[model samples]
Target chain A: MHDLDVLGVIFILGLTCYAMRAGGYVLAASMRDDGIAARFLRLAPGNLFIAFIVGGCLSGGLAGLVGTMVALVTMAVTAREWVALSAGFGAAIATSAIAP
Target chain B: MTAAGFRRGLVAALPFLLSNGAAGLVMGLTYKGLGLGASHAILFSLLVYSATAQAITLSMWASPLPVAAMVVACIATNSRYLLMGAHLRQLFGGLAPRKILLSLFLLADASWLMTSSDADRNGPDAGYLLGSSIPMAIGWVGGTALAYAAPLATNGPLKLAAALLPTMFIATLLPSQWKNAASPWPWLISAVVALLVSHFVDPSWSMLIGGGCGTLVSMMERTDA
Candidate 1:
């Protein structure tokens, strides 16, 4: 790709993403009406990465599944949020080499 | 601070931390796999301060240009955070400039989701929003360090990491305003898009695009109806 082309993409992208975040919060205030469009975009904490769980299991096998399960259960029981994260993450790597 | 606000910031952020930390582990594994030592992995986690980007970078480290490309790509991928930051500007607005800068460095999609979720769930409280950031940063650093220190010691299936984090996060943003559709759909849509894009697009910017696309399409369809 030409240098100018690359620079243009980067510039546009940086502008777009920054704009999205800024716009999201700023526009959030005037969002008094629950029009269909606003409601759709206002969907909180959009599920961006859950597909990774399925993909990980499909590729990584039972060990990966177990790792996922461990994390889920931990989240359920503790509800502590961040501190409980390592359990499932820890399981994924340890089991990566294991057959099961 | 409301309990839900605290939980919203911490709980909702879990899925993000899981993905990020696990991505960090993958980087660590790759760094070790490359015979480049864990220091590269640790430094990447601490300094570069991104998960999937770091994972891509670990592979590219052998050829430094690729790493540069990865940085460009990843920054573009998660550039939405800039937008998220803009939305968050109101939270720490009254604080001194230094505090806002400190807040900005720790701010990420996951943390912001949690904090906003808290605010939405419990009415706007700038103090709660700021308070939530404290633990959020700790979790990220601690999670990364743990993963970096011992890759094998890392547990959980990638799915669990993926789901659990978002699950907690989505849970925080709950008590919804929209009854017709689920909030988690955006996340689910993004994940599926990431799965597809991971196959074709460069890893850096694909997921964020996927997410933005998901949010936009859903809303556009609603508007058109």
Candidate 2:
């Protein structure tokens, strides 16, 4: 085992992230206005956002799941981001406090 | 950028800053625990500017560094940003190369979402994009510095605070987008696939796979319709 060069690792990681971020713009230039890819991009963010949180919520266990449900229901009903977030956080914190 | 525009962006990003800060604090403490110095942690936060990517980097850091493995790991975790940038094509698509470079370099999920939502609701403004980005950069880098200067545990109140962060994206999505969703099947399928992938595959690749699957399904549905 050997300690890696800290700065080198950071540089490579940073460059990789930049490439991924910029690569989208380069590829997007070819996207037709009404193309399938265009439509996909339009709806992809929300779906991707959902996917991003799935693991986090699942790992949080039952409390996390309940909290997520509360948040989703609150958002659906009230359409208020903050209020829904509060409901979710309240559930998570309360559940953690009681169970942890 | 107009002062008002910039201020509005900053205010809009404030709540996100809190969540980002909590995550940053945890990361900073982790770096310290790993025997990395404060300067190194700060540089890492500034350059990478992603809590998830930073976390993956930290986990991947080991003897001999497994540099190739770490690169692949970061790519898998961050492939979402590619889609995010594509989403912004309509907004940043027309800008000069230099301007686009600056904006894309600073972009993150929170800023990208806020900027895109703002464009959809209120029309795209370059200033708004910068407005949203600057605050997030501050929150992320500032949070790391604060945490390195004063380390904090990941659990306890911090854990609860961190727990609350992910749902913000869902809340952002449902308020306006959910009502307008042509069919909920794509999202449902994506979420289920993501859950399954998270269980079987490395969590790092789950989001990209799930998102790709969701996008493909949605495209196919659109074609069918």
Candidate 3:
């Protein structure tokens, strides 16, 4: 494809992304704060985050699993993100080296 | 819009410079391998600004690009943002809409998680949200440009480790999301459902489906109780 066509495609995709990012906020603005929709929104983040972790772990395999566990434990213990992330990265790299 | 919150957020997000930069470097290498020029690759990273969307779209890239299908795939993969945005409204409802909307441009999963956790403790600070998001954007866009220019030959283990960063970052937030006895049930359900959905359907849809199902169960449990 030509450079211009690629740019056009990227632009369109960008618009689509921004729309999704903004769409729910705009729609939610009109809803009653105490409604069921609000309840669902309140309950959604944790579930969504859990699902993300599961999907990520499954795709990432054992190394991913171990790394995430280490990260979670580190966070739980230290409450430091940088420490957890560094530890997790180290664990994942070590696991990958051993297994791969 | 407190400068203090913004400064704290920026400092807190400094770690993403390493995590996001590593992941973005891998993406840049992939884009280069796909024959994309530096300008195009950088633009894609800037405009799309989503690792999941860009990764999925890259899998579908071909000559006479499948524009319609790509758009559909992008929507499907990014649908989580809709839920996130809705929840953001609940958190930052009192903030100026224009400011919120502009800040949403740089919103990312890690930054969103960080902002949500912060809000739970410090109340909603739009400045923190915007502040944290900036470094993530920089790490991603700058890393792409840097990788394109350098094209470093990264090894397998190093790349795998880098790829795990986002997930690891999210994993760190899991503790804060826990509410009480009921939290574990929904989280377990979400994990099981996500695993099944990822196995059966497209992996991209797993989070929305699994998370939605879990949330429904939580609501039903609440009603029953």
Candidate 4:
């Protein structure tokens, strides 16, 4: 492969991601602290990430399902992110190893 | 670049490095499995810094790479950032354009979430944002390097790393503060919408739809008040 080819891909992909992120700020520069809009923005992060997590789990299948539940229960009971995460990771690893 | 900002950012970002490292390790392993060179993996992480985009690119690794398709896929996968950026702008738009632009560079969803949640109490702090981002960026790049440089065993434990990304999200969103903040209905509705849309439509779009609908439900509550 040509050296220039790799650079070209990086340039295109990097620029695209950067543009989408920066462009949103530019477009919304004039936005005021409108009540509804602010509320939406405030809620957006939690909502978006939650949705993304759901989608990620879908792709994860059984491992995702079991891991997520384990993590949720652990977090609820212990309130320790690391512990919850370890439980989830161990479940996923074990499930994948035995099943796959 | 105040010392305080850097310190806070670094501290805030340190916890997330684990999840980011896991993600980067997976990407690195995938690239290595594809037989790409270390330089290729490093460059991809440095430039893209996106697991979804890099994962898609990995699927298309070939002699004559489908460069165009890969670019399209990257853009489509990253479109969620648009909403993230909007959220950030609303929180911190008063800052100088340069600082805001700089923060946007290498911004990850986890950082955005952490920063946004912080903005609720302390106003927009570029220093904090930068602090958090530095460690995360390092984790991603360093994790990729470790994967290639060391060539660790690819067993069930390694594959389990993939699950960390989503679990990280759960950890971030399900903290006691968030749980006590409000009713669970909005989050539940959003998850169901996202799950169904992801099943029927392209999973990428499910994020926007679920978040959009969930935010709308939240707005309705605001209206009722």
For every model in order, the TM-score on chain A comes to: 0.56, 0.62, 0.66, 0.59
Q: lDDT of model 1 at residue A11?
A: 44
Q: Is candidate 3 or candidate 4 better by lDDT?
A: 3
DockQ in order:
0.18, 0.43, 0.47, 0.43
The candidate 2 chain A region of ten consecutive residues with least summed lDDT is: A37-46
| Model 2 agreement with the true structure over B108-178: per-residue lDDT tens digits | 97788888888887777667777888878877787878876764655665556554454443444554545
| Cα lDDT over the full model 1 | 0.48
Candidate 1 shows a clash count of 31
The Cα local distance difference test for each model comes to 0.48, 0.69, 0.78, 0.68
TM-scores of the candidates are 0.47, 0.65, 0.65, 0.62
DockQ, prediction 3: 0.47
lDDT of 4 by residue, B1-225 (tens): 356766777897896678678657767776666566789779889888876566545544555666765665565456657667777777776776676788788688778877777767676776677788888999898888888878486554664564344444344345542532256667788899988887676565666678667757766663421
For DockQ, candidate 1 versus 4, the one ahead is: 4
In candidate 4, stretches whose alpha carbon ends up further than 4 angstroms from where it belongs are A1-13, A16-29, A76-82, A96-100, B1-23, B30-40, B48-96, B103-136, B163-182, B223-225
Task: State which docking tier applies to candidate 4.
Answer: acceptable
Q: What tens digits encode model 4's per-residue C-alpha lDDT throughout A7-92?
A: 67877777877886776677675544454544454555565556666766777778777777788778888876567767887877
- Candidates 1 and 4, the one with greater TM-score: 4
| Candidate 3 wrongly placed segments (more than 4 Å) | A1-13, A24-29, B1-41, B50-104, B107-136, B179-181, B223-225
TM-score, candidate 2, is 0.65
Worst lDDT 10-window in candidate 3 chain A: A33-42
